[model samples]
Target: MSNESSPLQSSLLVSERMAFKLHRQGMIMETIGKNNAVCNEYPSPILPKERWRYQMVNMYPDSGQCHPFGRR
Candidate 1:
């Protein structure tokens, strides 16, 4: 046994640093819906692409622009 961290540990540290950097650069982990609210409390678990799709489909119907979920 040696008193040194493994390569995997170092890699994990670097990854965490990069994630923080990206987040600080105004890059949200997920997208907000039409209501201008995030679905989940934590944006990390939410997917941006899926949220965008849902917003578009819900905001605009096939015929024209309408509120599918009902006006708030």
Candidate 2:
């Protein structure tokens, strides 16, 4: 594996750092879910706001929905 960050990876890391700094300064940031149009353009295995998927799954175990955005 090459120990180098791709342009996209670098951008993500920079954004994550900036978000962390903002969070420490008491600025709240909301993650827009993967279903958003922008995310589709960049399609990745990792979903944006992935934590919400886990929370939803836990809350609706019997919902019978396999997707984070609910049934198609």
Candidate closest to the true structure, highest TM-score: 1
Full-model lDDT for every candidate: 0.41, 0.42
TM-score of 2: 0.35
Query: Model 2, 1-72: lDDT tens per residue?
Result: 144357534544555555455546655544456667543232233433434331133443566543332211
Best by lDDT: 2
Question: TM-scores of the models, in the given order?
Answer: 0.37, 0.35
Where does candidate 1 have its weakest 10-residue lDDT segment?
46-55
Which whole-number lDDT from 0 to 100 does residue 31 have in model 1?
41
For model 2, what is the error of residue 59's alpha carbon versus the real structure, in angstroms, after optimal superposition?
Answer: 33
| Candidate 1 runs further than 4 Å off | 1-4, 34-72
Model 1: per-residue Cα lDDT at residue 3: 34
Candidate 1: TM-score?
Answer: 0.37
Off by over 4 Å in 2: 1-3, 29-72
Q: At residue 35, what lDDT does model 2 achieve?
A: 69
lDDT of 2 at 33: 60
